[model samples]
Target: MTQQGARWTADQVLALAPDPASRKAGSKLGTAGPWSETGSADEGTVWGLCKGSGSKPYQTVVDLADAAGPAYKCSCPSRKFPCKHALGLLLVWAGGESSLATVPEERAPEWAAQWLAGRRKRTADKAEQRAGQEARSAADPEAARRRAERRAERISAGAAELEQRLSDLLRGGLAAAEQAGYGLWEETAARMVDAQAPGLAARVRELGAIPSSGPGWPARLLEECALLHLLDQGWLRHERL
Candidate 1:
């Protein structure tokens, strides 16, 4: 079946954002004038470059047909969603700057190539591994059950530890967490990893930022906590799935 075209718009682009900082940064960079060029190739890749604040301009490229969303990398220090650079580049592309010639001779930089290759390889490997696992499970129901049980046990232990940590954080209050710094979250995340729950560990690390992230941090932290709780609950109940 054929797929639908992307509904690209400034509002749609901004809605993909998860934070206000990214929106503000995107607005700032969007004023840097029109893109030099924009275009989509036969392979479904959309590319564009726009002027940035520094001496070097920002580059943005997206595979509109890919379900994984756009790939973005910028020289900016802001860890905000899409970043200002990405937003600016997308703005130009979504506007009327998408008629540039194909530049076949322009090769990707070593770093970009390496990163892209690694991502592709990792995704391919994961798919292959999952397929293999499914095939094995189809042939061996007992083995699959044992694996599921083990995973459930590990997840349970990780959830318990995370609950304890959250309780400690609440008991001490948000101010204490700020004084504890990133090391506290890193250490907690490490513990979560050791418990075989890397996903939970990642969320824990993200939660560490709330204390130092200015006003309304409590609300943000609570939201993250609720997400973590949901993850823990889901894993505990749906391990077989």
Candidate 2:
């Protein structure tokens, strides 16, 4: 829905379920049997009325354009973040023209229109607020430059320190590093964190996974180490780059 009229896959819709039970329950209602007034909009909204045990059918709506993944709302009493009705509606929507029809904005039911209008308004507000903040930050160019310089200094220091550690590890032999296991990498990653170098810390943390990555791990580890070493060198000499 977010990328033109491209419909979601069944697996993608099912993946949003809070748990296996929700997936199972939601799957049962995916067909047209228990649903009516089911429709989707090109603007990434899906809504339907699902027959429930109660006399009145439950209303379910999904907003695919929501920044935080697909947002769901259903009149059902289920406490799940995405109630079964919402999941079913999404599942039906994912099936494309054969399963669900597209209703024009003006033709959409009152309840669904109200919710969609509110959501679009809130999303617009958030975008406007973010633009204002970015404009304010841009207004103080000197302060922005100073902040960038401080972060660069920290990253440079982290890179130099990481280079030294890699040199030591290679000198002591990769077998020793394998024996040292995750502990060595975790400790090194902590130092990168202290330096406020999130990128370096993340790379170091990933190195810890190499040992348990099955056969030929040593070769894989060595290759990754070479790349990390190169990254460190590049960061250290970024001014020349």
Candidate 3:
């Protein structure tokens, strides 16, 4: 609570604990006895190395940048979110019991820098995705429907053209395919791509790749060609289904 705001109150720190035991444990360690290399950077991220039972200190970080929300990360093996270490950190910083909680004049440590950078990137990506969704939601439904219809029409035309290619291949016999080379299939796939029929384009790409699909590839090629033909016919007669 009170993320991205001024220093947190003691009650606010306790309120975010995973359990009462965590809150009590956090309160005990809040005075910075076992904590070191502690400081706030960027006015949002507070971090420190908490000496625990283990020989190495556990790294704890709490994000208070959002104001609307807060997040916690710790290198300790606690199953709890905002584990004791994190809560202790919030307490240590907010209580201002130790110089460890002061703003660092130097750059953040390697661990804090890495985590903050990753968190920032994740926030940016989520913001972009949310913006896209909001834009789509705000778009005119009629215009969206018309755009979809245009895409469908283009796909249908591509499918029909693919059907013609499949028929020609069948008429010429599957044996000639071994000699036809991938160039012809590549061209057809490119045309389907241009026509906006990703399904047809992918089918053509599979056809191109079948020749090199190891031993018994000829049988595989025949099966795949038949499947493509069936897809073409199905699309052409979809109203019947």
Candidate 4:
């Protein structure tokens, strides 16, 4: 599990089932009847031997340390990511099924131990990769700073252009806006998109939507215009902001 990972809820366990039939099958097997030697480790591993139609019992192991979610391995014939037995094992553990017992982390059986080793290696590799990325990013500080400055300048220009458009709309009075429709706003928004100011472009698109809005449109228009002016002022005072 990743650091401070949340425990899986019962719904989350069931959600892993590939189908409703699998989920039902898994839920039924969640009790202690078909399982033996059930054990969980503090380090987030669960394992059990499940009796099957065959003479031999199937081995099921779940490694909950996976950052994405618990991972499963079952010697049963099912091809599911978590075979029914694995799901049953997790569900049983979740239900506090009487068969299970807690043990020290190092007490994992050989099969589970092998899986845990692989999980640890994969986790270590990911951590190392992230560390390398951070190191490289730190090494190129000046380039990152220049990129940020350029992006801020583009946003500032976009904000200024949007401010001018809003001023023109107010002077022309929004009543005339019924005739002068979305084309003007779409063109302005496209320019903002070209300037790489997605935030401003999104606001412009919202403004374009106001005319077609059936009721109390003038109020909505005024409110949106005020917000546009706020963005303009924010960019003008970018250093303080």
lDDT tens per residue, model 2, 53-121: 999999888888653346778888999857789878887877764657776655778898898889888
Ranking by lDDT: 2, 4, 3, 1
| TM-score pick, better of 2 and 4 | 2
Evaluate all candidate structures by whole-model CA lDDT and list the values in order. Answer: 0.62, 0.78, 0.74, 0.76
Clashing pairs in 3: 3-67, 4-64
The number of clashing residue pairs in model 4 is 1
Which candidate gets the maximum lDDT versus the true structure? Answer: 2
Cα distance off (Å), candidate 3, residue 104? 7.4
Off by over 4 Å in 3: 1-4, 101-106, 134-241
lDDT of 4: 0.76
Which residues of candidate 1, in runs, are more than 4 Å off? 1-4, 28-34, 41-45, 62-71, 99-114, 147-241
lDDT of 3 by residue, 1-241 (tens): 2333567767656655545577678888788788898888545778889998879999888877742245678998888766888888888888866565445424778888788778788988979997885578568677667767787788788888988988888889776665554446766877887777767876785676565445787788788888988888887788789
Give the lDDT of residue 64 in candidate 3: 78
The digit string of per-residue lDDT tens for model 4 on 1-241 reads 2234545556656655655577778888888999998898778888999999999999999987653345778888787666789879888888776668878757878877787888888999989997886677689998668867887888788788888888888999987554555446657777887777767776775676576567788888899989889878987787885
- Per-residue C-alpha lDDT of model 1 across residues 90-187, encoded as one tens digit per residue: 55545534354334313444433454556567868979998999899989999999987887688788888888888788888867665665557766
Q: Could you tell me the lDDT of residue 104 within candidate 4?
A: 70
TM-score of each: 0.50, 0.60, 0.53, 0.56
- The total number of steric clashes, by the backbone 3 Å criterion, in model 1 comes to 1
Where does the lowest 10-residue lDDT sum fall in candidate 3?
97-106
